[model samples]
Target: MDLTTLTYIVVGFTFALYIGIAIWARAGTTGEYYVAGKGVNPVANGMATAADWMSAASFISMAGLIAFMGYDASVYLLGWTGGYVLLAMLLAPYLRKFGKFTVPEFIGDRFYSKTARVIAVVCLIVASLTYVIGQMKGIGVAFSRFLETDYTTGLFIGMAIVFFYAVLGGMKGITYTQIAQYVVLIFAYTVPAIFISLQLTGNPLPQLGLGSTLEAGGGGYLLQTLDRILVDLGFTQYTTMEEGNGFNMMMLTMSLMIGTAGLPHVIVRFFTVPRVRDARKSAGWALVFIAILYTTAPAVGAMSYFNLINTVKPGEVGAEASNLLYEERPDWFKNWEQTGLLAWEDKNGDGRIQYYNDGNEQFAQTATEQYGWQGNELTVDRDIMVMANPEIANLPNWVIALVVAGGLAAALSTAAGLLMAISSAVSHDLIKGIFNPGISEKGELLSARLAMAGAVLFAGYLGLNPPGFAAQVVALAFGLAASSLFPVLMLGIFNKRMNSAGAMTGMLVGLTSTLVYIFTYKGWLFIPGTNMLPNTAEYWFLGIQPESFGALGALLNVTAAYLVSKVTAPPPEHIQHLVEDVRVPRSAKEAPAH
Candidate 1:
């Protein structure tokens, strides 16, 4: 079958699988809707958590980002995975023992203040909404390519599919659906990595292939060869760190780690398991599943870069015959060009495509004078790297179809989880907990569904008119979560003396600080043309990127909470007992009194 037909079939099959799972595991109660009735097996929950955490950015864009950013991209790998360790050790088991349906509920009960719960809900919404915007954009890109639809149309279709499964099944449905999604997405991601790895290095494992010698008769390791080619083409060396990228990489890693631990969607995953021990084991299993793709990603990045350089320069780098003739470009090139993702302008009318660093002033002289070149002629979107990698390496149509399915799976699974987080906060925390304490279970469930529908529409809107930081918005989302949610949650559990006043004050301070810093550079609320200053390291406070500012915000939260707690009365005796009970798993599993 052709690419289009195969894509349709594969993507169609995955959708059917998800819908089937949703139908099979439909929620029957608010507990099921919120936490899958707290009965999911540890291993299954772990896989589901992996699917939920690995967003479209991880599946579709991360390898591509690493391909371009080189070693600098290690921050993402470290930061994201590192946070899970923190969650498993410091957060997950205790939270699971607490047995709350939502993150805001824990904060509210721990602080003994409805006001604190409301603040936590707002923080969860802000963090989750920002995160969902990125997922929606990813869905649009994946659908637009494989399904041959416009972005807006693709987004709506994706939203509809999410609504079907997410609204009907809630946590119960989504958990099983995500397990299926994990299988499909992981298989799709690894198959291409294996194919390309074997093609370049005679090794089937991409992680091993990255370190192996090239099969193309290159003189050194594959990374060494890649580095040589990139440097020759005036790009950063593929394996070495480039100088002067914005932000401290360590600090950036910490922010992402904290953000990962703090994200309501992720933390809530632990609540679905049957026991606190299961929560701990589930976290470890999640890391194992995630590491499969994470370890292979660098290999995919390196191989794709190697393949692109070799395709464009089939011979010696500067030779006239080395460039791929514009008219003779492959079918894959034409295919992407139609989507406007890959473009070329034959500057100087050379009739050849030059893929090089045209912005490198030091190399411009040699490029133009010696080679008769007129700067770089091609503009390939970084987001297309992984999607295009299979075609670039001449992989079969089925592999490409699987990639489309994988991207969709990754995007949709995370989007569903985030929407669930948003809706639960609105319905369970805000409405049922505070506004209408007497709300019936039936009314609460309806409210949750309505809240979910509204969140989907709002997220879709944000996807269309995305912020300036849309490309890097996942990192920003992490920042917001780390700053606002993680610290407060950690304090609530570990600091029994922490009062509602302190928790509330800490959350507001952390949230405001992160937002102010981000908006100052990324535009006020990311509005176009509203930035107070250019988003550059030179203009940053203490040379921190807005992405890394989460660490600072987190620090402020801790300090502010501590100082405020010293001046305020300690949490009531019951609240202290509640904290102690959460710290140690109890048999009764009842909510402690206020």
Candidate 2:
């Protein structure tokens, strides 16, 4: 079948699977709707969690970013997966043992303060909404390309598909659906990688293939070959990171870690497990599943770099009389060309395409002497890396269809999970817990569904008019999570002395500081062009870029909490017991007992 037809088949079949799962596991009770009735096995829950956690950024944008950034992109791989290690070790089991429907429930009861719950609800909403917006935007982009629909129409269709399963099934329904999604996404990710790997290296494994010898360079190491090829074309060494700031990289890693641990959707996944032990085991399983793609993505990037340079350069450096002109570029090149992602300007009046390391001083002079080029004419969009990979490698049409399905699966699954988090926070924590204690379980479920629908609409609207790249939105979401949420949850779990005053104060301080910092430079909520000043490497604090400042915000939160807690009274004895119980999975037998 053709690419478009196969794409429809894969997408249609996946939608049917999700809807079928939703119907099979209808949420009759609030517990079922919120936590999948806490009966899911560790392995299944782990797969579901993997689906929930690996958003479009992981599925689509990560390889593209790595393709361009080289060694610097390792931070993303390490930070994203490493944060799950932190979550599994420090947070997941405790939260599950606490037997809470939502994150706010643990914070409110553990701190003996309704005020704490309110604060948590706000943080959850902000984090989930911003994140959902990112996922929806991803869905729209994938759909527009694959289904051949307009972006808005694609977004609406995606929103409707998610709404069908997420609202009907809630957590119970979404769980099974995500397992299938994980299967689809992971397969799609690995197959192309495996083909590309074997094509470039004798090795079939992408991770190993990354460091393997190149076929084109007569047994030279792939990285070394890339360095030579790109350098000859005016690009920097492929393996070495540019000399910018190492401290900022460290901070960026920390921020993503804390932010990941702070995210409510991921935390809530633990509660789906049958027991506290299951929660811990599920976390371990989740990390394992995630590592599969994380390990392979770097390989994909390196291979893609090889392919990209080869595609652009085409013939040998000295053989070509003139470079590829704008009119003579391939269909793939021209398609991306229209998006302004792929640009070729005839600098120095040369008809040839000039793609190189424009930022490297060493290559600048060599490029001038050799190619007579002015600059890197390659204006390829980073988002196009994965989407264009199959074409770059000359893969079959079915693999290409699988890529679309995989991107959709990644986007839709995460979006559904985030919407569930948002809806549950509004209905379970804010509406039912605070606003109307007398509200029935059924009423709350209805409200939650309505909230999910409303959130999807808002996110879909934003998706149609996306703010930035998937990775950019993902980074911003992480920064917010680290700054606004992680500290409060940590204190609630480990420190019994944290009272309402301290918890609320810490959240406000952390949230305020991070937002102000981001807005001061990123413009009010990152709309752009309204910054206090241009964010330059010169003006930052100790070389702390806003993107890498989540760690600082987290430290600030912890400090604020300790100082405030020292002045405030301790939480009640019952609250103290709650903390101790939450720390142990063995004592979880009676948690959900009737």
Q: How accurate locally, in lDDT, is each candidate?
A: 0.89, 0.83
Best by lDDT: 1
Q: Candidate 2's residue-wise lDDT over 494-570, tens digit each? A: 88778778888888888788878777777864566878967878877788877777789888888998899899788
List clashing residue pairs in candidate 2.
234-357, 235-357, 323-352, 341-379
lDDT of 1: 0.89
- Clash pairs detected, candidate 1: none
**Candidate 1: Cα lDDT at 102:** 95
Q: Could you report the Cα RMSD, in angstroms, for every candidate shown?
A: 2.2, 2.3
Residue range with the least summed lDDT across 10 consecutive positions in model 2: 585-594
Query: lDDT tens string, model 1, 1-594?
Result: 889999999999999999999999999899999999999999999999999999987887788778888898889899999999999999998888777899999988788888999999999999999898888878877777778887789899999999999999999999999999999999989999999999988999999999999887654799888778788889888777768664588789999999999999999999998877899999999999999989988998888878877777777777888889988988888888877767999887889888888879878778888887788888877777888899999999999999999988998999999999999999999999999999999999999999999999998888876663233678889999999999999998888888888888999999999999998998866678898989877898888888888999999998999999999898889888878877764456644322
Candidate 2 segments exceeding 4 Å error: 315-322, 338-340, 347-349, 361-372, 465-467, 584-594
